[model samples]
Target: MFGSDDFKDQAVWEFSFRIDDGGFSWDYKFKPPLWKSVVGRTLSKNNDVLLLDASHDEPTDGREETSAVFQSRFLEGIGPIKGVIYGYHQGPEVLKATGNQTQLKNWLRDQTGVRVYRDNVRVFNYGEPSDDWLGLNVRRINRPGDRFGTNSLVAAISLDLESSYLLKEKTNREGFDGGGAFPRFVKLVLSAFERFEHVAIDDRKALDDVIRGKGTAVAPVRFLDAMDSLKAGVKSKNIPKAFQREIDAIEREYTELRDVMVSAGTAGLNLAVIFHEIEREVDALAAAVERKLDEQSIKKQIEQIHYMLHGFAPLLRKNPAKSIFCSEVIEQATRVRKSRFAFHSVVFSAPVLTKEEPDFKIKAAPNLLVGAIGNLLDNAMYWTKVRQELDASNGSRAIRVFDSAQGR
Candidate 1:
């Protein structure tokens, strides 16, 4: 009942049927035209065939209607079977219909209930094996020095029989018991199947060992492990946004510090000229204060001025690195900005180094460390001024600096 519209012109097939012993035999005559189509010309002899037992469970008490869809007709004493032959012409049209190898494989598995591996099939030219085997799971056996050219193509014969009484039926069959013709045919097919199964098992084992990094196969198991981790949702933290913010902050701080250093350099040069010209004047002013002023406050002011000038000198000088107490660094930075604190009326607090507390010391260039702290204080004072102008009632224009001891 094969028709061109049923399977398209790309379908080529053959089939056979037989009644009880010599009763009636039916087979498709492979005419000259079909024979011409069968030989792949440049290929080897291609009449390889496989036999499959398509047995399934008998219908249960309540599932008879559902199971009936898979049932086949009876062939007299040979049990129930619905015979069919189907094939696709291995041409561009077939490839277009199948789409790709993956789709072709899926279609095969859906129709045949078998898993196909890439190496399951091979073709052969004169005597050498190739990988050009066409559709219908045509697996080729590698036989060196075969004179069949490229006529070799593997095919399977699937017999759909009821599973519940399949063994009993086989034993009862006339030609199947006691090593008859049927037994020989069955044994030959079984042997072929056994060989194929062994090959499949070995192939699977090699693949498994390679995947686990336990064999000679040089697969990238570590890379596969990483891919597995990613599939399981192991993700790294997304820190670019936070990192960019920190970078921007550092850049802004650096720009301010550079501007401050440039201004200090100009002030330093002016101070040097003033120091030379006012050196004698400053001394005379201090002596006059000690001699005639007689006020302790005036004397302390003169000494403070001398101290401040020396402190400013180090800002432009090359101060060597040494272990300076953290308390001293904080005090030096605060001391330089003490007047600005008063001028802005901003409340400031700093840790008072006491005998009970351990003052931390850091090895650094004191001038650079003090300059960094000074820049921080400048930022705090600027923000504090802004807050006051934004809302006077808030009245929170304050800056506090503190250090912690390990135990405290």
Candidate 2:
């Protein structure tokens, strides 16, 4: 009954059966198996297990399923037993049988998926290393990015024998008979895993990107492209129109989310640049003080630094949409670049704003705007230095920033 081909592998598996005692009922006065009750008591408090009762209304009127329509109705009414599923790695502490940290870690490393329990007794070979009851390992090997392997989870499905009569165990005591309710049980379990994988994969990818310093920019683009490919592949198959519509909706949502991430990432990168710029200025200020520069010179430098920091106040505000004078933003950015320009022997030319233009304000995140300008200055300084080296006559390279109306 437990042939390799008979039972296909999956991330989630179902073990449905009823207790021998007729008194057991999920609705009222339901006595859970020792293992199930223990698990509910122990793991439920820690939120390790996600309990779902898929119990449906029992057929009131007894009707013989003689016709195909009646058979379909009967099948629809049949629901799995009330069971709880526990996902490992969903929390900080991994599930373990022993209290020893080393032993628990070893168990997590060695164990393969969830174990099965029937009437407080563990069903052997179900979650054993050699057992691939749900084909979790197989699916993981095929699609590593989206599937969880054997070591990643632990779960148990318990059912009473009297309530789950349709799920019959094989004569060899290996597994359930692969007939009638068995296939439906497998389908129900797989459906839950399918929903879980959707969210899990995104979280996994996001973490990986952060660790590798790749940022969130690449994921959305790749996801959208993959969706397009999947949509095309699904179109070739004889799938329903609703499936296509759902896919289209998902694609649209991903696109919007990608845009938001891109905008946020850009702002973050800008802020990083501004932070470095500030650090450089602070270091220079510290150096002048240590060198025991003249009091007047030191005071002037301190005032300049103060002015630069004062200009950054708008950028540091909590409300990013606050407006600031465009001229002031430009002046602050140019001030940050002054030391670099002088060190590189670059002749820098900045625009002179008239009285009328001084009042011109732009709605932008102050730090991001300054960071963008700083990056432009960095590029200009680099290219100017290159030009200076290439031409002996050009001892100093020039950078000019002017408004178009000025024609300078």
Candidate 3:
């Protein structure tokens, strides 16, 4: 049983950084990429240390120390950079109108990966800035308020999945405008769903023509064209099924296309789900440890996960130990000291907070209990959003929070 105490070991981290780059940068904190917060909670437990020895290992270590190798080696010949990089973007894949849609938006945000940024319409995964350019056109929106209004937040999103049409500009509030890379991806995905919708109607028309033993049904030409477009959407390799409603229409119309289309739709849903989890994992990880990961390595790991399952080997080369699952621990290390005179002994102990507790003090003052409540309220708010576990093996939410006066 790996308890919280098992986690604080210095072994939880690795040691290595570029000497040429001067001291340490963000990447230096995580000798093992997975040891970073992302894998900490969900995976940080020491399961036999299957990778490298914390005390003695180099970055370019051996196979026993790796878990995601083919990620780099296998992708050596995967593409026209544009096509390959773009493939996963849309196949990867949003919302809204008004009324309940807004309520749903809040619910959706709560449900989607905390990494996903949504406001009635768009969802963003623009944090931790990935280092690799896998066809993803990342844009940094630095405080929309300063450039637009005072109510602004700065964020960066990386786009690597491939797609055909993009929502780069705005449209008639119904379809899409297609301006930013994300919008274009959304619009094209929805458009593909539209194509799926029409195919059924077209199929009906064509069937009518054929079954009537004449040109009475719509026309096989029309239905066939629909099939072509549907396949094209599939072939794009983007997060398919972005446009779901259209396919649902098709499912109600033609049973054949519905079968294929539905399967694709499910895959799209799964893609969204996978991405959603990735977003949460990423957000939690990124938020927990800003400068711990090698941005390039994170990019590489994502790409590897995106492309080859075999690639997991090299990806884990540096973090095979942390790539498994998430766990929780409450560990505290303490010490006691006695004076030579022995009148009284002072116990100076650093109790590593586990089981998550508030570390701030509350004092009643004249006329400003309001301020005290405000501080307590603010501290509470921070704790709620954060998953604070102190074990280095456990990705810690915040370093440590200081509570109040102890009753002797």
Better of 1 and 2 by TM-score: 2
TM-score attained by model 1: 0.28
Residues 3-64, candidate 2, lDDT per residue (tens digit)? Answer: 33221122122222221112111211111122211221111121112211111111222431
lDDT against the true structure, per candidate, is 0.41, 0.51, 0.26
Give one digit per residue, the lDDT tens place, for model 3 in 18-126.
1111211111121111211122211122111111111111122122121211122211111111100000000000112112334433432332211221222333332
Between prediction 2 and prediction 3, which has the larger TM-score?
Answer: 2
Model 3 misplaced stretches (Cα beyond 4 Å)? 1-158, 161-367, 388-408
TM-score of each: 0.28, 0.33, 0.15
Q: What is the lDDT of candidate 3?
A: 0.26
Mark the 10 consecutive residues where model 1 has the least summed lDDT.
Answer: 65-74
Q: Write the candidate numbers in order of decreasing lDDT.
A: 2, 1, 3
Model 1 regions more than 4 Å off: 1-294, 352-358, 394-396, 404-408
User: Evaluated with lDDT, which candidate comes out highest?
Assistant: 2
